[model samples]
Target: MSATAAPPRAAGRPRRTSVVRTELRRGVGPWAGAAVAVTLLVTMYAKAPAWQGRWTDATDTLHIATALLAGPLTLAAGCWQGGRDRRRGTLELLRSVPRGRLRRTLLAVAPSALWPVAGQLLATTVCLLATWPYVGGGRPYLELVAADAVALASLGTLGHLVGLLVPWRLTAPLLAVAGYVGLAVGTYTESPARWLSPAVEHASPWEEPVWWFAPASAVWTGGLALAALLAYAARPARLRLLALLPLAAAVAAAVPVLRLPAEGPWRPDPETTRLVCDDGAPGVCVNALDRALLPDISQALAPLNERLRGLPGAPARWVGGANAPGAGEIGLPDHTMDAVRGRLRNPDLYLNSAVQWLFSDICDSGGVTEADAERLADVHLAVSEWLAPTPEDYGVPVGPGAQRHLDALRAGSPAAQRDYLARYLVADRCDPEEVPVP
Candidate 1:
């Protein structure tokens, strides 16, 4: 003790800060923080281009990145760190120290609990910065970032609990594998029960952007972490039952989210859905999420719009939601932010496919007969050829049948082909066979 400092109030009763500091010293020795950092870097490295080249949407990228980097790997690290004292024959010594087991365990798990979250947040900060230029046009959804962080922290704490209970050498790796598989399968399933899993849900149109759903996951996971902490810390058999209160609370909070039909924690963002129009006719408007893509999308669509000018049944105003009231409204390309690669793999081609959807009598589905299926396919092919003449245009694909029809259309007078396209587009129903592939 320093010469000026007073003695402790009682033996075994060290200052609270000193206790936490001691735990940090012990927990950090295992290099848990470094492990978290390394895991994040290794995982995000492969998707480096996603930060700028493709997905450029910071929040969207974080959603997937957290799923892969934040939780499972940190859990593995936590498992190893939690068991260190026991493995080194220090647990009983630590327990004998002057302090309640609750305070001691809390201090001990703090580093294990926090390093993973710190790593996630740090990596996320880097990714979020890349979206700065897009800030005015569209903002990243950060609620998801917080939710995922809570989930990772919970996993970290739970891993520690597992380690204390099972001190085997293989515990760390097994927990890591289990964590990854649980998250992967939980996200993959359509079941609502699995919806309670820590990963972010897939973004969907049916679900609007609602704030509560995101944090509810945090509430649920945070409860689990706290419960695990209490159960592991307390020596009295009855105190462990108190852990059930938080667990029950967690289930209560998760019910509303799990009951949701689609994979969701979102509802529509009206501000996001608010249309931002491009310069002129045939007019094009994009939703806020895709607003940054508008400049490029507008430029890409220019040739198509120019060809469509002054034609009957051609779209007058292009709306992005993919719903056209009549021939006057066309659905401009809305880039779906799937978890994969953070963006559609091929924007132009996917957009071209949207155009094909617009012209179809059925618009891409419904129990159709064999003859109708063949017919609709032919009509879609012809429409696709007309809209995107070259498959090379921004990666738009032209199938064999479509390419043959496109070649035939190109051979004909431009006026005649345009007239054919105009008629085909507005048709309520055409037997696909009735519509010439050419």
Candidate 2:
């Protein structure tokens, strides 16, 4: 008697087969090893002294890289896993059944490529959380999550398409490497080129109309994803058309949504970037610092500006603190939190440490007693030197003679001091601002 065949599967109803699941489970081990290897590489590089706090700094960047890589790796793995059937000649047996190319490809691709995206997103969150305490926390954790989702979905589709395009074993890795290189080159390019990178723009701390970015990226990534998915569904033409999605997305994002009114004095001066502030800010205030401390800060800066003005070519006009309504403001980027933990442990690039270094030098001189006014002047000199603004630079007016004092400070070795002028020198005399009568 002839061998009996199995019943045909109903149209659009995929046959109940454990083959896809089993293949995915079996293929996961190697990919897991790859992920471990990548993690180790990042960990080793991050611990180097030169890159101190680098792991924290690079966390956001790493999240993007991980997302970008996940798609291709999963696709390759799926393809490799699916290829076994072809090598064994079981592909013909499977194809001979009721399921068409699309359903078969979906069954082959879904488990290997789609399932791993969840794991990637989870890993990204864990990595970011681990870096929070060390670095000033991750950059808005929510943004990272969304970016990862887009990256994984796009890559997964691309990988599946690649798998379908090249049924051969050797082609996937070579393609992956080439694709990675192309992505790297495109991402790092200047002006016109930066838009071409696979990575999305890092959001500005300022709240503006960034809604465009999400949709633009989605449309771009979605198109590619659809193309890739279609390729997996055995539609080559759709995959080719979708290949342009990234570029299209880049073009959309690169074009400014809201152009500045005009580049004139009346126009909003980017130089005077606005400070993040709260209500009843009795004076021009930065949210990053306390309103109560404004008086102390103003007094400390005033004498320094005067001493600097005495020098040749001192700034004709200098304003301390956040600008008044018409004037521009200077503060840290909007991303900086009011409460920064380890930030204090870091060096003070601007004021306190600089003052301390100069005061230390003044103290080292034998038989020279330094008064509060003298110390203030010396620290002021140190600051001018550090600022080192070019001709016509905005800031405190420092003349030529003061520049000489600054030159001396730069040449000398300075001690590590935290509260150079503001806290230590006049803490007792400094008057704190009282809460205003509401």
Candidate 3:
């Protein structure tokens, strides 16, 4: 090599690649890869089943898991790398390196960012695969993946910055964990803390983007990045505070532009109600008060009169006045009377399940008799059958488990109904007739 010859450049430009390599050497911790694999497996197990059914419900779980796992890990990695100079008492040595302070800082922190990027990529891939079978074209998946990637990158960057700024070894991990918790809580509470967390925007085809880049979140992340850069520069105290400008601007921007809704009582909106009615499985409807409330004999069946015109008949109409009360009799019709009001007085059946309580209430009140209950049951059964095709013997097949449920209502004891529900309603897979898991 000639004396005073300039270092060979890649593409005729002095290569920054070595800096990246150095950053990787210093920033990529020993445990990062192991943590990534563990996180991937856990996320896949939790999210892959969304394709089986209850797609929304399953995706929600995935969203939460991604945030919790990725968020804290990002912060931890950044903090670990940030403390290196202090731990080694090599801040002066680091300053002596032959590069601009900002460039050197970038190089030092760049490697740590790699792990978070990889982790986010893995999460996005898993989520896509889980959702792809159900989504038609690639557009929806692409949109979701793109949004997720941006959101996660911003989050990782923010965590990395915090790790650099905070000098305390133990305090960084605690802050990371606390930040994760606080962001989660803010989703439910709409508190100021939520501003710090990245808003994962998993938009479905029918819905609009959900805060893909909220101003506060963006500002916080950007501010963190700038602060880390300045810290690397070893800027004076006067300039250190300037690192906060982006964050302040972010908060200011969000105040008017973001306008997140306050947390409060949630009355069912028209769209939600329509979604429920349109998509609800036969015999399965969304209750305003609860996600899984189903209609049983007590709510609709018990209120009708036995003498109503269409007892045991199609398009049945009520003939007797509801005003004229009748005795609460139990069991099927007699030879003389075509229809009779039967009471479900089996206390054991009545107490074990929510459905039983509903049935008992109807029977106890001068509500509908057995004939009235039967008519309503039949209508629901027919609707359910049309919606979810199953075996005829089990009753109208409404999805996978509706038939079994209707059968239980027909002959199984209350205990049997409860046990039957446990099989699919709350278990690993969708019951078809079952509501979403809480």
lDDT of 2 by residue, 244-336 (tens): 565565445445422312221122223223443322212224322223333333343344443343333232332232343333222221212
Question: What's the residue-level lDDT of 273 in candidate 2?
Answer: 31
lDDT (Cα, tens digit) per residue for candidate 3, span 100-173:
66667666666555666566666556655565454312123243334334445555555555665677778567
Q: What stretches of model 2 exceed 4 Å from their correct place? A: 1-23, 29-63, 67-79, 131-144, 190-196, 200-209, 231-342, 347-438
What tens-digit string does per-residue lDDT give for candidate 1 at 259-354?
A: 886635555556555777887678778666555566666666676777777777678877775233445686655555421323345545655655
RMSD of each: 5.9, 13.1, 14.9
Off by over 4 Å in 3: 1-14, 29-34, 51-60, 136-169, 190-196, 199-206, 210-220, 224-245, 256-258, 262-438
| Candidate 2 local distance difference test against the native | 0.44
Candidate 3: lDDT of 276?
22
Q: Which stretches of candidate 1 lie over 4 Å from their true place?
A: 1-19, 28-30, 48-57, 135-138, 205-209, 235-241, 262-264, 322-327, 333-388, 391-438
How does each model score on TM-score?
A: 0.75, 0.52, 0.53
Q: Name the best candidate (by TM-score).
A: 1
lDDT of residue 155 for candidate 3: 54
lDDT of 1 at 109: 79
lDDT of each: 0.68, 0.44, 0.44
